[model samples]
Target: MVRYLILRTLIFVGCLALTWLLGLRDREEQLLAVVIAAVASLVISAVVLKPFRQQASADIAERVDRRVERKREKAARSDEAVEDAELRRPAGDVDEGGSDSDFR
Candidate 1:
């Protein structure tokens, strides 16, 4: 954003200088000065505004990514916890015919 500001400021100053120089020529009309200034201002405003808007969009994307990652991590942790609990549980009580023979 700071770089964009500097670049836009340079452009504005350069355009204003050019306008001033052009106005000095005998053939140029005074309206040319106004036109140049207006065009310069419009261009500078657009140039300056572009990066800030882009940065804002990037910031939003970063936030969304962070939120998604946190959700995924939390989900994974919850699933792991449930799996651990399941693992710690004892086997179900069931009677098999000839349990001693089965063990043998």
Candidate 2:
């Protein structure tokens, strides 16, 4: 991801520099030059950086899958702990009277 970002940034800077070198910076419509440069860079990057973008996306998806799996495992462990605790409780500890003092 970082490499892709750096590559994209470099492409944009290169386009911007090229536009500036072509006397766009001194033109009265300087914003037009910036816009043109941005569009050009975006198009070029979309084509040239396709593989990098795909790789980054795949990496992100893998990370998300791992996170979800971890969460599921943690939840399963928590449920097991609760069940174990209930199983370990004495049968005589039942609140037959349903009184608040049982908690105390």
Candidate 3:
């Protein structure tokens, strides 16, 4: 992520400099220069930074998948614990004559 961000920043700065050198250096043309630089950087990065962007995206996806797997494992462990507890309870502890809500 950091690598991608730094590279993108460099591209923007390069584009900004290029725009300035291309006759948009006047104070009144500052906004135009920035807009052009931004667009140019975006296009350039889309082509030049494709690999880095894909790598960052894949990294993020992998992290999310790992988190989801961990959550699933935790839920499974909790379910097993509940099942084990249920098994350990005395079968006669429940009143056969009443619904579960009777105790609540």
Cα lDDT tens digits for candidate 1, 1-104: 56656666677667767887866444456567657766977777786678676886788799999999999999999999999986865565324663433244
TM-score against truth, every candidate: 0.46, 0.86, 0.91
Off by over 4 Å in 2: 98-104
Sort the predicted structures by lDDT, highest score first: 3, 2, 1
Query: Mind sharing the TM-score for model 2?
Result: 0.86
lDDT of 1: 0.72
Q: What clash pairs does model 3 have?
A: none
- Predicted model with the maximum lDDT: 3
Tens-digit lDDT string for candidate 3 (1-104):
99999999999999999998899989999999999999999999999999999999999999999999999999999999999988987766766665443375
Which segments of model 1 are wrong by more than 4 Å? 1-46, 93-104
Point out the higher-scoring one by lDDT: 2 or 3.
3
What local lDDT score does residue 94 receive in model 3, on the 0 to 100 scale? Answer: 64
Each candidate's clash count: 0, 0, 0
Model 3: lDDT equals 0.92
Each prediction's whole-model lDDT (CA): 0.72, 0.90, 0.92
Clashing residue pairs found in predicted model 2: none
